[model samples]
Target: MAEAGWYPDPAGGEGYRYWDGDRWSAQTQLRPGGTSAAPGAGHDPSTPIVVKGSSDDDEDEPRAGLWSQVKGPVVIIAIVLVTIIALIWALMQLGVLGNRGPGPSNPTEFCPAVTDGNYSVDPHPRDGRVYGGELSYPQLGAPWSAPTVDGRVPFGRDVQTQTITIEQNYRPGQNWVASVLVGELIDGDGFQSPEAGMDMVARCIVGAFYGDSPVQREDVTRRPMVVDGREAFMLEMHLSFDVRGLQAKGETAIIIIVNTSGSKNSIYYASIPDNAQQYLPTARDLVNQLRVGG
Candidate 1:
């Protein structure tokens, strides 16, 4: 209907007419001067259609149009979506979306060497209610000391006092471990196996209490020394109903629960296998070994 102003795109699809703001331009022409000869005449189909240059005065140009049909709203939307994803990634690197509780992760590099000696123990407080015998991992000789301390685990303050004790004594039952092999703990509740994906750091120990006969492996994932001949692992989970974190009441704390199967029973991870390793020592002392009131 109106004049245009751009050039023709050979690769553009059929009827892919673009506005140059002045006239029509086509790549493969059916006739000379880009005009079809009424289609009835016995005409040559492969006639070359030569395009003439615009004879407008070089100095005299037309005004800009209302809107560009080429770069439409859909193109704009795609660009916006890409921009949003980029921004989210940048924010995570800046620690903006970081809500993980203050604690260091397990020192994966530190492998507790295996030897032949006493190795099973559970370091939880006196649970008078539940009745269960102690578990014992056969034996791993002299406990493996971290040859070189890479980076220590981290922990939070104030939140460490009472909860860390529970995290330090958690153990995984054999069934739980076996279940984890099949499914995943996607919902943060051990989708397939309860032990595979426990509810919290505290539950990690409690669930392993009576289950898993003939304790097979030592809880040396990130366990620390409890007694002279035992290795232990303690973990603190940041639990809330939903949303991956504790929101209201600002209750950002960890439950330090530990458990082990050994010669006697009971184990304590001197430090917790927590992201919040910094605050674990204090939490361990207050919750497990502390003496209150003078």
Candidate 2:
């Protein structure tokens, strides 16, 4: 079929070609525009061909097409996208969604003056300390002395506020850790700052002290606590002593962490080697005796 005049389309446009009808011979030949060409003008019969514009030799330019009409819309859409991105960037620069928003609520949210509760509010005798709600939450324990965190509590009432401090007079023998957590718990969404809050400080302390260090199974310790009249938790670790960047030969000492987000939860751990193993249960018993709701 290919050898014959009209050739079969290998690329699948139109179908087979052939001798137009005899005498003239050869399949069919299209001129520059699909018009049949004269018998034989030396044009190759087998070459794949296409027809150009069928209009006359001289034609004026056509008007703009639909694509041209769409350019304005495309440009507008691009501009809108850029504007949105710029707005977001500006907001970020203004410290809107970043680490620099409003600080946490005052540490003394529900203080004694606000409500007639047995709780007493006291500053930690440090500058920047804000409201302090010191009452033995009747739930955990009562007549408790809750002071503002070690220092740097909320001094200003509005906008930015925070309390950050670290206090450690941990009593391992009694399974008691005298900690001064500085932070706040916001009443609303997670917008509240973490200073004056225990979780961040405790985690920081734990990560700093015991992180990546070795802990023997037998040396592991966990204890219970009542924090600000809430159920609490604790942990203590015997770390090999090291100082001045020198490996001081002794067991590493560390306080793991204590968590008590529950009611009547008991913790375990001790500082004194003898009581260390006996720490948690005893402290838990005492915590149980604590009157938290006052």
**Cα lDDT of all candidates, in order?**
0.27, 0.32
Local error of candidate 2 at residue 168 (angstroms) = 13
lDDT at 138, model 1: 16
The TM-scores, one per candidate, come to 0.21, 0.25
- Model 1 poorest ten-residue lDDT run: 176-185
In candidate 2, residue 161 scores what lDDT?
Answer: 15
Q: Which run of 10 residues does model 2 get worst, by summed lDDT? A: 156-165
Candidate 1: where are CA atoms >4 Å away? 1-53, 56-67, 73-78, 90-294
Model 1 C-alpha lDDT per residue in residues 47-86, reported as the tens digit of each score:
4443353434322333223245445886988999999989
lDDT of 2: 0.32
Which stretches of candidate 2 lie above 4 Å from their native place? Answer: 1-63, 91-151, 155-294
